[model samples]
Target chain A: DVKVTQSSRYLVKRTGEKVFLECVQDMDHENMFWYRQDPGLGLRLIYFSYDVKMKEKGDIPEGYSVSREKKERFSLILESASTNQTSMYLCASTLRGGQGPKEQYFGPGTRLTVT
Target chain B: DQQVKQNSPSLSVQEGRISILNCDYTNSMFDYFLWYKKYPAEGPTFLISISSIKDKNEDGRFTVFLNKSAKHLSLHIVPSQPGDSAVYFCAAMTSGSARQLTFGSGTQLTVLP
Candidate 1:
C-alpha cells in the first residue's frame, strides 16, 4: 500500500507568522499536490510539483508557496499566516503514466489554525 | 461561479437502503470525473472515476453514473451501512497538459443503522 505521510496532524500559528507544512510520499510518484479543504469550498489546489525544484500554482495560490527539495517530499509555506488561511491542508501524489484521470492517493491531512 | 457543484448538502438513508449522491458541472471542457469519500479529520480518498467515453463504472457496491448531456453525475451506494457515512466530493478535470482538477463543495451522507 502507498503511504502519504504528513509531518503534523494539527498546528496552531499566530497571524503574520510563517508556517510550514511538510508532506512525504513513500510511493515516489512523479506528481505531488497541495490542497486546502474547507467546508462548502471543497478542496482547492494551492501548489503542485511534477518533479524536484519544479512548482506550479493552482487556482488558489496567492499567499502560499511550495518547496520540493527532494522527490519524496513537498512542503507548503505560508508567507504570512492569516485567519483566513486556517483550514485543513491535504497532500496528494499520483503515478505519471495515466493520460487524463489516473488514481490519486492522499495523505492524512494537516489541520492548521491561525489565530 | 463554482465550476463543480454538489447542490445537496446532506442525505440520510437507512441501513440496507440505496444512497445516491449527485454532482454537476458547467464546463464542457471537462472530460474526466472522479468521486472521493472523506471521513472526519481525514483526507479524501479516491472512490471511483469515469471518463466521458464511458457512462457508468461500477466496483463492488459503489457505482458512478455520468451524463455528459446534462453535465451531471451521480454516485450510488447500495446496501448502505453506518460505516459508509461520510462526505462525498465530486471532481472534474479538463483534458489538457496540466490536468488540473476542480472540486465540488461536497455532500455529506449519513447511513442510519
Candidate 2:
C-alpha cells in the first residue's frame, strides 16, 4: 500500500506568521500536489511538483509556495498565515504514467488554524 | 467559474436502499471524470472513474454512469451501509498535457439504519 505521511495532523499559527506543512510519500511517485479543502470549495490545488526542483502553480497559489528538494518530500509554505488561510491541507502523489486516471494517493491531512 | 458542480449539498438514505449522487460539468472539453470519497479528518480517496469513451463502469456495488451529451454523471451505490456514509466529490479533467483536475464542492451522504 502507498503511504503518504504529513508532518503534522493539526497545527495552529498566528496571523502574519510563517508556516510550513510537510508531506512525504513512500511510493516514490513522480508527481506531488498540495491542495486546500474548504467547505463549498472542494479541493483546490495550490501547487504541484512533477520532479525535484520543478513546480507549477495551480488554481489558487497566491500567498503560498512549495518546495521539492527531494523526490520523496514536498513542502507547502504560507508566506504569512492569515485567518482566511485556516483550512484543511492535503497532500497527494501519483505515478507519472500509471493506468486509469492516474489515481492519486493522499495523506491523512493537516488542519491548520490561523488566528 | 466553477466548472464542476454537485448541486446537492447533502443526502439521507435508508440502509439497504439505493443512493444516487449526481454531478454536472460546464466544460465540454473535459474528457475524464472521477469520484472520490472522503471521511472526517481524512483526505479524499479515489472511488470510481469513467472515461469519455465509456458510459458506465461498475466495481462491486459501486457503479458510475456518464452521459456525454448531457455533460452529467451519476454514482449509484446499492444497499448503502452506514459505513458508506461520507462526503463524495466529483472531479473532471480535460485531455491535455497538464492533468490538473477541477472538482465540485461535494455531497455528504448519510445512511440511516
Give the per-residue lDDT of model 2 (tens digit) for B27-91: 99888899999999998899999998999999999999999999999999997999999999999
Best by lDDT: 2
- Give the per-residue lDDT digits (tens) of candidate 1, residues A91-113: 99986656869767899999999
Q: How far does residue A31 in candidate 2 sit from its true spot (Å)?
A: 0.7
* Top-DockQ candidate index: 1
How does chain B score by TM in each prediction? 0.97, 0.97
In model 1, state the lDDT of residue A15. Answer: 100
Candidate 2 docks at the CAPRI level of: medium
Q: Estimate each model's TM-score.
A: 0.97, 0.97
Looking at model 1 chain A, which ten-residue stretch has the lowest summed lDDT? A95-104
- Shift in Å, residue A103, candidate 2: 0.8
Alpha-carbon shift of residue A106 in model 2 (angstroms): 1.0
Candidate 1 structure quality by residue, lDDT tens digits, B13-34: 9999999999999999889999
